[model samples]
Target: MVIMKKMWKNNQARRSVSQLLMAVVAILLLGYLSSFVYFRLDLTADKRYTLSEPTRSLLKDLDKQVFIRVYLEGDMPIGLKRMRRSIKEMLDEMRVVAGSRLAYDFVNPSEEKDARLRQEFHNSLMEKGLKPVDVVESKQEGGTDTRRVFPGVIIHYGSKNIAVNLLSNNPVLSSEENLNQSLQALEYKLMHAISSLVADTVKKVAFVEGHGELGYLDVLDITDELARYYEVYRGFIDTQSPNLDEYAVVIVARPTGKFTEEEKFILDQYIMNGGKVLWLIDAVTVNRDSLSTGETTLALVNETNLEDMLFRYGARVNPVLFKDLQCALIPVNTAPAGEQPRFVPAPWPYYPLLAPRKDHPITRNLNFIKAEYSGTIDTVGTSQAVRKTVLLVSSRYARLVRVPSFISLRQIDEKPVQEEYNQSFQTVSLLMEGKFQSVFTHRMTGKYALPPGKTFREQSLPTAMIVVADGDLIRNEVRGRGSNPHPLPLGYDRYMQQTFGNKDFLMNAVNYLTDDAGLMPLRVRELRLLLLDRARIMESGTFWKTCNLVAPVLLVVLFGVLVNIIRKRKYGRPEKFG
Candidate 1:
């Protein structure tokens, strides 16, 4: 009996040790597996915490360390604080994919106690291309205080660095809406900056300038903007042999004259070689200079000779002018001529404020695009291979005026009946993609002599083009009050002092055309903002405060009571031996 008891005790001890070992091994295994597998569940309705696939891929392909310095820290307004929080979250998510390759720091340049030091810091940031914004804070007592802040970031990768402005300000939008748009665009802006810095080669873009297109001074703003990402060139298409092979994209902005057969053939063959083009053409030409004299002008149809070419390629620029009820304003002289002229803002129907289509990435979430005597675009031909998307359209109350119509400034004083403005959603800009048939295919034999040793191509390689019916869409007004003429922003309205989305729209179109890695699609990621009703919040502040203060404590107490009851029931039962 003693031997049996000893053997039983030894077996019991071994079993107990085995159980302990198994528990230890399970814990170690779980710890090891967790190190390799990492994931985050985005529970927000807008998926605000989710990183885009392009961002993940970009981070995963990092070859060197990327360092970022964000100058958005310190005590500020609530909106700025929220922006700072968003930046931190985005960087944390990026770090997960980039591992140790990505590093970032939040800095407050205004933290220096000395005024001179702070100014110096601000100047340095500005020299590095960071823009400063003046923020005003309302004091609790009665007054207000102003603070200059740089809501921007500088990204450094290898030997290159790029600056990104975190705030997207649209004068037309409310402050809250602008802040929301800034937050929504954070991902695209950051990713674009990173991609630009890491690019191996700079792309080439040219502005076609032969056919009385907009002068260099008119397109100065867009030229300077595009110069940041590309090697911009200004030249006419070669008549002998227009080899556009060196350029990734060509911009034919606001051509006023017709093209010769040779020039058309060259452009056709260039498309056949897989080149992208942005056609900013006006179907109808109205003399704005005549309008300045307070006289009516006849809008005549322009014969650019490229309509047949465009029609063959699956779209046509109609020769009709569009007027929308949702239009821009211009200052008009309401006072008598003898008395000092009092300028008052009056709605100008000819200047339509086009809203972007929400479906396309190029125009999604963009503000109004200012148009002056803009024409309509019609998709033609039944080619299944070509894809057409309208990027910009008129509002619900719009009307079309045919060519040879009269335009007078006196129309501003006459208010039209809303019922008469029946036309709605006229397409002003279009994006076309696919293989295109050459307009010169049938007429290539005799009309246009082929250049020596060059064969005419009947069909084009897969390519893309953007057609905008308004030529003035790409032109910037020049302000000449000072000694030197300063070009205004692309979509700025002097009367309202507001800038529209013209610059962003054109930039997006170019980026979409040149993008090969599908990064431009990141602009489509939408993060909806939930805002509180100010009046309701103010009226029910006490009730909300009381609930917030008392609810958590009550829940904790109730949870504790329930747990105690469960614990007592689980352990208080009588023990039974098996």
Candidate 2:
């Protein structure tokens, strides 16, 4: 009986060993296959882990290795830690498709042992255009600790490098929402840089000159920014030959002079051929220089000659100035005329802080756009083919001052009456898309004919254009006089010491207009923040902690006791019964 029992035990042990060996072999096979076959299941409700189609396309076509150095490592706030994990997950998913073509490493700038070396490293990053954010954390034992954190990345593709600041500092949004916005924009920003850097043939964009458009100096900052992604040019429209075939996009920024018939025809034909245009026009003319002298300026109708052309296309910039209670502040001399001028900052109604349309990708989550002597935009034209979207509008308390009117600094003293400023939500910026009917469709005479071989298209190929009623939206402030002058960043207010969203809006507009890969739509992705209730945690801190600490151990103990009882019932029973 003892010998028979020993043999039975050995047979049972051999079966157990065989099952274990098979399980090990299956695991090994799975690990080997996983190396070649990469797949991840994104069970997220928002699909936040999944890469957009455009981004995947961009990555799949990368001929050269793109190395990214992310500086978001080390000790950070819980929000930043979450962002860091997200960045890693995003890069991991990207690497699944890109293989070795995409590589990234997290770097903690504060990891340096020496203080001076760390400072130098931070400075180098700043020079490369990576903005460093100062974070203050409260200690458990005492006061707050301050540290400069760089939530940015430097991407290198071949010989060129691009710096991208990952954090979005929208003053209007709370910190959590701002971080969420930054995370939402990560794919767009990274793919934009990659697309710009990996392109073998760089596309060209032109700033149309010849008409009294904003000068090179006035648009220096924006020009520099756009140069990173496009071959930027400044030249007069070729009225004689009238061919803009080489340029992908053309910008007509705040042209004070009139557009000639030939010039308008060229622009119209260019759009007809699937080209993009950004039109920043002011219908009313104001001597902005006169305001600096603390005097009233005559706001007259500035005849740019393109009004009729634009009206026919889809939009009209009215001959008026927009005034909003939600406006920017300007320095006003509070002291009497003779006394030492006490220039105090006061709300300037003419400088309307236009609200961005939340629905559109171009202006989504953008800060208030600052405009000087802006005019209202009216969507005209009933063509179903042409789609017009209002991208920017004035606040609830907006008033339109008619042209041939006086705009005086003395008006600051008079309190704004709620009844007078009744015009609410006036459109100041518009985006027109789809196949635009040519303005010169029926009116194209021999003078408007293109140079040989090219036929005039009465209807445009599917294209887009943005018309902003404010010209000064693209203009930056110059600090010094003449030769030594330095231009501040676009949307920066010197008096307020704050930068508005003008630059971002323009960049977004240009990006949307020129986006061929359909990358702009990815900007619309949103991740809902499911935050833990702080009050509940504070109230039941110890209770939850005890549950978290003891529940798992109790579960394991109960599972072990159940397993032991099953073993006793099956194997410890009397052999005589069997």
**TM-scores for candidates 1 onward, in order:** 0.87, 0.93
The weakest ten consecutive residues by lDDT in model 2 span: 569-578
Which parts of model 1 are misplaced by more than 4 Å?
A: 1-39, 123-128, 338-342, 445-455, 481-483, 533-541, 558-578
- Candidate 2 structure lDDT: 0.89
Question: Per-prediction count of colliding residue pairs?
Answer: 0, 0
User: lDDT of each model, Cα atoms only?
Assistant: 0.87, 0.89
Pairs with backbone N, CA or C atoms under 3 Å apart (clashes), candidate 1: none
Model 1: per-residue Cα lDDT at residue 566: 82
Tens digit of per-residue lDDT, candidate 1, span 404-507? 99998899878888998999999999999999999877673555544466667888789999999999999999989358999998988988788899999999
**What tens-digit string does per-residue lDDT give for candidate 2 at 42-114?**
8989999899888898899999899999999999898889889988888899998899999999999899989
TM-score of candidate 1 against the unseen true structure: 0.87
